[model samples]
Target: MIDQSLIDLWHGFGVAFQFHNLMWSFFGVLVGNLIGVLPGMGAMSAMSMLLPLTYVMNPVSAILMLAGIFYGSQYGGAIGAILLNLPCHPPHAVTCIDGYPLTKRGKGGTALGITMISSFFAASVGIIVMIFASPLLVQIAFKFGPAELFSIMLVGLIAGGTMSRGAPIKGVSMTVLGLILGMVGTDVNSGVQRFTFGFPDLADNLEIVALALGLFGVAEFLLNVNRMGAVGSNMKLGMKDMRPSRAELKTAFWPMVRGTLMGMLFGAMPGTGPTITTFLSYSVEKKISKNPRSFGTGNIAGVAAPEAASHSKTQVDFIPTMSLGIPGDPVMALILGALLIQGIQPGPQLITEHADIFWGLIASFWIGNILLIILNVPLIGVWVKMLRVPYKYLFPLAMVFICVGVFTTQNSLFRVGEVAVFGILGAILLLLKFPVSPILLGYVLGPMLEENFRRALLISDGSLQVFVATPISATFIGISCLLILLQLLFWLRNLMRARKVRESAGVPT
Candidate 1:
């Protein structure tokens, strides 16, 4: 099997290395890189816009190009996250936690450099995993049902609840608020509107693009308007200044490795996309760090781990899609639709039947990663220079991009207005000393949690024991409990410490 796979992969290179296919790959990554730097534009929008062009192209070249755009956007997303605090991609929201802090510290270039390195490293590992272990991983992925999914997502929410830089109560409160906001749309099971009041637009729930851009991008703009400062304005943009020091590199290396492993694992599982892995990766890094307080203060590991996880998970997301005829996320569904348009079916037999398409796509992954590294590494200075643009000029331009991006998501002016509303809300949260990242987390996970939880209950006729009936779900439940317990214990310890200090100073507790 291994030898056969090798021979087929070599033949795939023969197909992917063709002149036309190479051009397609280059064009896709180039365009994707550019789109990624823009606020609100993501790989899905870019690919959807270009999906029509694939109808006239060969299957091999079409998939290669789309695949390139997908991963290439992953590479470019860190730039906006690091340099401008705009999460051009959902996963990049985690990057903003540390990436923007690094930018404020004049290490934006170093953050971008580390981003590229981690991206390539994680993509390489993910490609290898796709090549050799996809079948086994697909089988494992099939074992997870609604009960298992709900339990694991519960774990994610519990862990991710502490993703703020402030007090735990505030973080948890923001997360709960996000969950409530996530419930804005019509109920999926009952078809009853929950929070729309009287608006038709709320029936589909709030757009993730609008929510993310509003909370992070527009809010930052509002808070900083007329403050008269460009990010990293005083930093030197020399090549040496952009490069990470040896110490920084060492600090980031292990996090990249760990994040890649997590990405590969979660990416192979259907329904668990890059967003969960990125947040979980960031949470794990914080949990295990010796200086956890430094996490939101420009920790390189915080940036490296989540970026690596997001990239690797993106690359490995193809496993369940190609092997089980399952689309892990909406973007993968689009790719699957493209394959269907080509009169191709994805399943276990796909590798044996469509060897060229399978292997060529794999080979293109390598080519695409190399192309991204070549295209973006030298452009670190160029991206960082956006910071040098006058704040008055830059914020308005960014707001335009954010508005356009949100509007394009549904061709709705209502979505644009939603951005302004959320922006105002975000500014208020910022003033209240609340963290915004957890809100995104709660919004993303809340619906899924509700859906899966309901599905599990329905399956078990309302018996909650179904949650722990399986080993996988049971294990996750255990982890969630342990996490909650640990959090409570830590809170108690901090309260006692505060009391001791107050007593010593003869002040009120």
Candidate 2:
């Protein structure tokens, strides 16, 4: 099987590793980095903008280029989070805790270097796991029924809430809001409008591209503009102040290893992504540290851990998406959609029938990860210099690209307006300090959750006990309960400690 797969992969490589394919991949990485450095522009938006170009290219090369961008953005997001206090995307949020401090302490080069190195190592691990585990994973996927899928989704929702920063209630509320937003289109079962409100276009429901771009990109631009004067006055780093010391490298090493393992495990699960992996990694590191008090105060481990996890998960997310045809996140879903469009079916037979695609895609991940490391290391100084560019001038150009990109999607002005509306909503959410990552996760998983849930119920004749009766479903729910209970216990312990501290200080409880 391995020998035959390699032979087919080499044939696919003839298409994916061509001069044109290499050029496209390079172009994709460059563009992806730029978008990643800019706050609010994520991989999804970048892919959406570039989707039209797919029409003119071969399917294999198109996917190769898109894959380059996908991983490249993970590399680029670290740059912004380190230099500025701003995160380019949700997964990079943890980077801001330590990355910005490193830059402020004049070690921006060190932070970028460690991130690059860790990303390469973690990505390589993820790819190797993919190569070895794909066959077994495909076999196991055959055992998942509707009840198992529904239970998995339930675990995802609960885990998402528990992993958030604030009250789980707030996180749960945001997820509920996302579910409502997801339900805005025509009812698939009844063929009647659900929340279209008399508009024909809306009957199809909200476009993912429009919602994502508006919420993250447009809203971020507005928020930045409001703080433009303050941002403009900050000093840019000189090249001499950028490099890290051997001590910093030693400090970052273990955290990177821990984060990579954490990310790989979570990323293998369907409906999870780098955003959750990063958060979980950071929280775990903070909990286990000898000097937990220094976590948000320029800890090098803080920067390295999340950066490693974020990029590592990007590679590992393919495990479930490829073998099970169950997306680990929104971007994977889009890739799955692309596969379906090309008449390539996904699931167990996918590896058997499309060995070339599977192996070549795995190979390209290694290539792309190496390229990102090579490209990002030398460009830290260049990225830091971009901070010197005024937002007044920069934002308008971003808006222009956004407008042109949205218009090109469906060649409709209405979509542009939709983007603007979402942008406002995104801006408001940012101001309110509501987490945006869960909302995206919610939107991506909502429809699938509802569909699987109903199917499971129908099969069981509305018996909820079926969820507990299935072994896989029972295991997942059990794990979910344990996680929630553990979180609650931790919270209560923290509260008790706080009260003790207050009492010792002679303050009222």
Best by TM-score: 1
> Mind giving the per-residue lDDT tens digits that candidate 2 earns over 84-154?
65555667766776776676665666777788778888888887667666666445555677788777767
The segments of candidate 1 whose C-alpha lies over 4 angstroms from its true place after superposition are: none
Sliding window of 10 residues with minimal summed lDDT for model 2: 227-236
RMSD of 2: 4.8
Per-model TM-score versus the true fold: 0.98, 0.75
- Cα distance off (Å), candidate 2, residue 5: 6.8
lDDT of 1 at 162: 83
lDDT of each: 0.89, 0.73
